[model samples]
Target chain A: DAGVTQSPTHLIKTRGQQVTLRCSPKSGHDTVCWYQQALGQGPQFIFQYYEEEERQRGNFPDRFSGHQFPNYSSELNVNALLLGDSALYLCASSLDLIQETQYFGPGTRLLVL
Target chain B: AQTVTQSQPEMSVQEAETVTLSCTYDTSENNYYLFWYKQPPSRQMILVIRQEAYKQQNATENRFSVNFQKAAKSFSLKISDSQLGDTAMYFCAFITFVGSQGNLIFGKGTKLSVKP
Candidate 1:
């Protein structure tokens, strides 16, 4: 019964570069959502993926995109990263859309310098 | 769009005492859900408790409980017999009944410090 897992607990990227964060959904879960948490702030929704398609997205720029694989794993890609992109990226897995409780991962901390 | 607000940016409580974190939300819809998530220093987001809009009894989990006021659109979390482990950043989240397609709106969060 493994919970949601994310890769690269910490990462460093340079401005104008690109970074990819990976997430594996919890067992028995199908939906995957991504969030960004800045220092001392709560997480803000990035987007959600279901059935290999992005279902809903937050007020993020086009530079932020995501993909969900057949195995329910997800990858968040940020292109042309800026220093403001530096934050903790959290991955959550839920069973369905309607008010389901989501289980979250430890999150990947990205530092852009 | 639904919005959640946590006015208190920080709070402190003595160990073995009780503390309450405040939260309020605005939504036009009749049905929705609310949640309290705790993010400790490790950065793992843990669900503390949740409340469905239709439930009037409120929701409780162990030492954590919620005071849900539908009319006031207020949802506050109360932690009793607080321990050092309970120190964390607490966030209030809201979601409508429209299903998973709706995104969760989170408050700015309240940082709780438990003094031993």
Candidate 2:
């Protein structure tokens, strides 16, 4: 069983540009969540999706959004990126929306210049 | 505010030695879940251990165990026989849900260095 996988291990974009990171949850998982980790800090929840609908969101702004597909894959899109948006974007998936153990991906390192 | 706190910013232990990382949490819910995740240089977040607040006995997974004090709202991780591979950033997290509004709250993390 392949674990969670993320695309474009590293990305570079200029300020005001839009970027989209992709994630494939572990096999047999249904829920996907996104998190942003700044340098020397822990990850903060961005949002969570299940059944192809966004179920919960964190304290992030409207610029950050996500979508979940029928196959359980998810995408995190950031609009009007800022230099401070340079951080590691991690995707985690669980069996459901409940408090289950979440499997995480290696994460996409976004560098906004 | 619901939060998790890791007071130690850094910790070190010699190979084969034991080390303890401290964590404290604040939450209004009586039943919740706690977790310890390890992030290495590769940037992959890995779950090391988990504990349920309703369980009285501490959870143990081989060399990793937790000392959970529900009354004090403390959850500390103890790593035994530390190895070089054990070096990583350890984060403590708390999760509580009312309906479907649950999200993990993670701490700043503690960098663990296992020396040779």
lDDT of 1 by residue, B10-99 (tens): 999999999999999999988888999999999999999989999999899999999999999999999999999999999999887564
**Proportion of true inter-chain contacts also present in candidate 2:** 0.75
By how many angstroms RMSD does model 1 differ from the true structure?
Answer: 1.0
B9-79: candidate 2 lDDT, tens digit per residue: 99999999999999999999987999999999999999999999999999999999999999999999999
TM-score of the A-chain for all models? 0.98, 0.98
Model 2 chain B poorest 10 in a row by lDDT? B94-103
TM-score of each: 0.97, 0.99
Clashing pairs in 1: A97-B100
RMSD for each of the candidates:
1.0, 0.7
* Residue B95 of model 1, lDDT score: 80
Question: Would you list the clashing residue pairs of candidate 2?
Answer: none
Q: After superposition, how far is residue B35 of candidate 1 from its true place, in Å?
A: 0.5
Task: Show where candidate 2 strays beyond 4 Å.
Answer: none
